[model samples]
Target: MDEALERDCVIAGGGPAGMVLGLILARAGLRVTVLEKHEDFLRDFRGDTVHPSTLTLLGELGLRERFLALPVTALSTLDGVIEGQRITLVDFGALPSPDDFLVMVPQWDFLNFLAREARRLPTFELRMGTEATGLLHEDEDRQPLEEKAWDVDAAVRGLRATSPSGVLEIRATLTVAADGRDSGLRRAAGLIPEESGVPIDVLWFSLPKPPDPTPPTLGHLSSAGMVLTIDRGDSCQSGLIIKKGEFTQMRRAGLDAFHARLTQAAPVLGPVVGTLTEWRQVKLLTVQMNRLPHWYRPGFIAIGDAAHAMSPMFGVGVNFAIQDAVALANAIVPDLRRGAAPVRTLARVQSRRERPVKVMQRIQGRGHRVIARSTTGRRVLPRPMVALIRLASPALRRVAAHVIGQGLFPEHVHTGSVTPRGGHGEVGGVPETWSKTRLWHNEGN
Candidate 1:
């Protein structure tokens, strides 16, 4: 066992929520460590759309230009196709500056960008290839991991994570679990998300993008299934929505039928369907829409997918998570800097952000249920309504575009200093680097 390390805050999972929180808090001069179970952010079937709200926050940090220099496909308009007729679904061009369009970058690239930026903070330590296994309370006040307490959670002092160096205890004034839906820390803390009754699953895979430098994002509905294609320069990240728990039957029906359905749904995309050859290429994402009844315990809090697992309908999952991080940092940076973790302050973070999340989830749950009921039709709206909306499409598109581009409660960046120009994206100070060969622990005094 390596010697235990201490930090102002220990965050589990280096996803958008955790990384963003680490970056902001460290900028406010708090010692923070982010633990990521994976060695790299190369996971596929992830939310990649960078919404307007996130872009605004990036611009506030003055890293917007640096970040946008990376490869991306900007989607200015969202459209839907039915029976070969195209209709504008959402137009982003009418939205605010710096983030009117949704930019489709690979999930890996987005994560790498955040990680690189976070590393520029002297107080932020990101440890990949490590995972939180259990929670810790002050002293022996920690409860057993198996016990379930609906209204109570141990005032977490820190957590234990398994790393290449063996089990190392991380002690912190505050601990945050941002580890996604199946979060181990959330379970250990006895936190559960209340189901919002969303009913849909997605089959995701990659297909060739159109030759254009920027392809319009398209949604196609057919008698068979609804397919969505988001352009990513060389490839399009495609997803087919199916009824909840229907993947087994879809597979039993065979891949040929699936390919046929894809072709029938969007003949424009037929040429690229052949690229998705093997069953191995297809990935199933079990959609979930739920939020925690309570997002915090005494010394700990849950954010992002750890607190709420969202449906993938609007591609706002990552954007919402980023919002949570911004809100959390703005609310708690002072306490962390002062060596305190007040439960009331943590509760306020959830209270402020919960309404927008609930509103988005309700919209998604209702929309998905409606989509599930339409089978004989090739479009979500009735033919008459589709035609009617098209008559006033320009006006309707802008309204929906604002909701998707800038969320109900968009969060702004509060505190993150731009990295020094001389160093190559690395901050001046050294952070604790824990490894099996040599255990390194550095905390700003």
Candidate 2:
């Protein structure tokens, strides 16, 4: 068995959030170790769209060109189907930046890129096939006790992980729970999210590219409910926005029934469903948005999905996770450099990131209510009501821009700058690029 590994910071979970944090901290010369439970990044049907806001962050990190070079599709516009007709609700061209639209790239490729970049940094190390079981607390000696200070112990397994080589105790000045929604560290810390009362779940599926497609881009079909569709380059993917815990019963009804309902929900999806050959080809996933009351607990803190898991309504889940990473890194890097109090630094991070997350959760809640309304409510709504919503398309576009364009994290993430003195130095400036003009006017003034 190898001896205990010590670092300045230990990040649990190698998803986008943890990997990005590792990259930023390692570049800042902090001894950082990222523990990932997964042996490899080979998951299918995961989030694939990188929003303009995330693209902006990539630019600041000097990785924009590399990210764009991956096999991806750039969506130039946002389209929605209302009453069975396609309408261009938001034009990406109206957004002031050169990279206006979303870049569709696989989550694995994104994580692999981050992991590779992290590996290149001397101060960073990534341990895959490892699981963080519990947190180790510092004893009263003011020194991390051999076992106590090494509070976060992870089980490190080799490539062919059968029997664990040994317990890998990571002694660090601070620990980050980027381990995702079902976080062991969050549970260990006894922190739970204050539910936002948004109870929408999604079932995501991918199939062979539709034979014939119309109005391809980010789209939604609204009838009794909202069915979202996105072009996955070679394949056309769709998500059915339903109430929480609805997918299991649908799956149990068998693939034929599932496909029939999907085709029926959006007749335009018939082409996409025709290509499905086997039940194994379809993937189902559930999404919810939750935020913790407090993001920090003494020596440990939570970020990304661990801190706030938003609904997939806007397809901003990964973007938000990456933004959280940036915010967490920005908040803590200087403190780590100066050896500030772990508790104080974590508190500052939470305060900085909390409001933006709350705003996002509220927006997601509103979207859920819109999609999940009753059939009578949707059909009986007057023409004036329909016209009002259509008139508000620009505002909706702006909201989309803020959510997807700037990412769920605060503005400092893209600006590579922080607020000036006495003005909430921990907080980020509002996203200026996603301006109201671009949102309401549909033109870059």
Error of 2 at 50 (Å): 1.0
- For model 1, the stretches where C-alpha displacement exceeds 4 angstroms are 141-153, 210-215, 374-379, 416-445
**Against the true structure, candidate 1 has what lDDT?**
0.79
Give the C-alpha lDDT of model 2.
0.68
User: How many pairs of residues collide in model 2?
Assistant: 2
Evaluated at residue 77, the lDDT of candidate 1 is 86
lDDT of each: 0.79, 0.68
- Steric clashes per prediction: 0, 2
Residue 245 local lDDT, model 2: 70
Candidate 2 lowest-lDDT run of ten: 436-445
The prediction achieving the highest lDDT against the true structure is 1
- Cα lDDT of model 2 by residue, 60-110, tens digit: 666688778888888877787765555666666656677687777878998
